[model samples]
Target: MEHDVPSLPEEIIVKILLRLPTKSLLKFRCVSKSWLFLISSYDFAKAHLKNSNDDRLMFGSKGFSMDLYTWSPQSAADHSAFGGTIYPPLDQNLLVQRVCIDCPLYEPHDVVWFEGSCNGLICLSSSDESLSLWNPTIGKAKKLPNSGTVLDFDYYGIGYGFGYDELIDDYKMVESLSFEPFAGAPTLDIQLKVYSLRANSWKTLLNWPGGHAFGGSGKFLNGAIYWSVHRLDGPIEWVIVSHDLSTYTFSVVHLPHLHNEDNDDVNVDVKVLRGCLEICCERNTHMDIW
Candidate 1:
């Protein structure tokens, strides 16, 4: 006689599933049609990300073509057999799992740019200025249509910010473009536009100051994406630029005072730590945090 496994309640099943890593959850989605539906649901995706124990650091490159690396902290902490991994905690080491994904490019010479990550979805921007939303876990990707701001890449340059808006249960893509001065124009113009996943449309927003956005990727915190930007005009100084996801407006945050005013060229970066924004400034000999 065959013994049957006990049926699990839906609530209990959800609790168990929320704790699983994305890699495993993707596989479990094939168990049944019901499971596939549940795992693919938006509510489940948010819950799983909120309750997940597997924190990972992802690294990608435009030069590396379709390849990426993710380092899992939970797996490192769980493995105690490796004595050499004891120095700075296994979570600190780069024990990476390499991943490769197929991305549709707008241009042959277009390079890949990992724009940002919110919950489990990643925003990808190509050199040709196309955008895509990707979920590495489920292996699902959606390409966003051109916002129609600049047709032939004639704009000076384009930058992006990605985050989620909880009030409306939506994810947003904030596109910032700095335009080169027209022949008669006095100063450079910066245009702003927002793409809403729910609306599946792009809406033009108010213009922001024209300046170069601190590169790499912006950090998303408290429903906004923050950028360390260098102002184009006035005295050379650094300012924090933030776009609120809910209000769809931009605001500037002040950085901590620097004792060495003469050394304004200090390297600065923003990071989220302990549920708050931390501005890190690196001096010649030491680093300061605020």
Candidate 2:
């Protein structure tokens, strides 16, 4: 007597694997050597990643050191299984991708961590001007070469963003510079610099798109990095800026009109929700989200 094992064609297997969640795919790797080989292929990696877009959330904190974790939202019906508590970490294993293993900075305040996660890679930046690309899944990291422009803290403030360029199959980090002249530096300047992981170098950009100051870390969505910006020459108003990683172009997104009588307490934040840009505002007792 002979036992017959079901076998799937490689093409069919690839399609099936692409639709599965990362957790399930990781387990299926043990099914056979063929499965593992297909899963580890470059084409399979790209297809699987594209299919898994917006399936999970990757978030990190800045205080002290830095920590990154991945969370998956559950369905409404699944709430009953949790006994009313939707605590993900308690119910599932939260993949802590990075935990400041060997800190690059002596003083935590001296350097800041700005992060953007894409296709299993996390890009990190520092206030003191350090950049790196890391794949948390493989525990591999590559420090980006500096753009060679020194920032004189006395006159300039900088913000960083990261995203992937599908056209060239590369990843990029865009740095926005805001300059304020003091005693000798008479001309106010605003500049931009971008680093390419594929080329392993940085290039400076002139004609600063807009004089808007980037408030904080940006959110990556639709192959671009989106940040909440404030125009330098205008009032204390907020606007959303998007920089396409592939084309290296800039576009401005107007925020939703808000009827805020008390502007002092109004707070706005930009985030990526389910593959779309979301602007959230809160003031006093009411909140408006768009």
Candidate 3:
């Protein structure tokens, strides 16, 4: 006797499917044609990004390679937070998914750097002046048009950043570079350029007023991107310079007062934690987060 199994209601099916882990959802797309369409839709992507609590960590190297580790947090475990990082127990096993990053636009040997990621989209750049926006979940990539000269991060104090502008619904990139000394130039010469996905071009912005930006990744939070900067005029002071994504204006964030005035050699690192800005100071063997 062949008993026909009752089909689940479309609404009920969507409700259950949207809450599943990302790996299972990705695999279940092959269950049927409708499933595939629902899983691949832009609306579904946005819902999954917001609803799904699939904690994932992406680790990449210079090669066109990346490994993703996904694990659920322990419900009853205690966590210690520091420098924008949460310390969880390391005993539990994690599922590692290896995803191959292919770039037909640039050579695989080119040194790769992770510019930034926003709304599940990742942006990467290499030494060859190539910029690409990649979605690891969908296994797809789009090479962005060359903005201008190659903004190499290898040089000290040169950094690149990527983010999304919600007001315009556009993805943007910022390149902060250290320029060579010229006649009549200040103690430090830095140039900034911003790229808009909708405009499809880069526009030169005013010079950074933080004196000099330390070589590091831009920490994007709230509505701005921040970098560790140090002023060389007067006494050496480390501060954070932020560029507002919406207004395109520059502002300075004062670092926490050092307990020891003599400890001027402390290193400053800017980071975003739980939707807030934080700075990690390291002096000798002591470290503090502010």
Candidate 4:
């Protein structure tokens, strides 16, 4: 008696394997060298990543530890309502059930919450000053090349998104870094450099119009990175500087001023409340929405 060999078409196997989460796929790669190569291929990873994005767009928040949550509009009565506090808390069991079963790349640390999310990716920087571009769904990550100098005066910014560009076929990451003297007083000699992920290199851009300082975290949205730019002298006005993710250009957007009583000791600040951007007035009685 003779036995028949069990076999399936390559396309069928690929279709089935794509359904597995990234972690399981990584382990299964050890089954064979061919499987490892197939799983690690850029094209295969990109396809799987696109499929994962289609699955769901999960957002996490930064706290003592990252809190991962999936937005389920279907669970609510009115999906069109923006401010309805209808989202359910995603418990550990549910996280295991959903993300673990389908997303093999769902490591606890990989779900990092940045100051903001943009274009299906999050901007992350390490305390050691290392930067990376990460897509959590498919576990695809690219470490950005560091700025050569650790000058105490250096400042860094990152932006990522898709934009209409006649020259490029895919989206890109635009990073900007500026350097100024720490002790010589703020001057016009500050230098700025911009990096393009597509080109995998950096180029010097025009200097900022005036002496400006950035503190806290940066937010990426609508093909630009927005951050608080502090002016040296003004009515305590905070400026929002936006760097075009595609063109690598910088522009300023005005922030709404807080209504305040004439008190010299009063202080105001800007912050993101829930998901909306808001300004906290000095009196602490009202929040002005811009």
Q: What local distance difference test score does each model get?
A: 0.72, 0.69, 0.70, 0.52
Per-residue lDDT tens digits for candidate 1, residues 45-105, read 8888778655675656445565466755566667644553323332555565666655443
On TM-score, the stronger of 2 and 3 is 3
What ranking of all candidate models by TM-score puts the best one first? 1, 3, 2, 4
Q: Which of candidates 1 and 2 is the stronger one according to TM-score?
A: 1
Using lDDT as the measure, the top candidate is 1
How much lDDT does candidate 1 score? 0.72
Please give, for residues 181-277, the per-residue lDDT of candidate 4 as tens digits. 5555543243455456667675666745543545434444455555565565454566666666566677876666544565433233344434454
* Model 2 whole-model lDDT (C-alpha atoms): 0.69
Winner by lDDT between candidate 3 and candidate 2 = 3
List runs of model 4 lying over 4 Å from the truth.
32-34, 53-146, 150-190, 196-200, 207-211, 262-290
lDDT of 2 by residue, 1-290 (tens): 99999887878878888988776877888988988898878888888786775556667664566655555554423334444332334335332233453333234555546467677777777656677777655556777777787666577677677788888888888877777656556444767888888888888766456644566666778788887866656466777878888777788877655646565456666878676778877678877778
Which run of 10 residues does model 1 get worst, by summed lDDT?
81-90
Runs in model 2 deviating more than 4 A are 1-8, 12-40, 75-114, 126-128, 183-188, 256-259, 265-267, 282-287
Deviation in Å, model 4, residue 24 alpha carbon: 1.2
Model 3 has an lDDT value of 0.70
Off by over 4 Å in 3: 1-5, 30-33, 57-108, 150-156, 183-186, 207-209, 257-261
The alpha-carbon root-mean-square deviation between model 1 and the true structure, to one decimal in Å, is 5.1
The 10-residue segment with the lowest total lDDT in model 4? 92-101
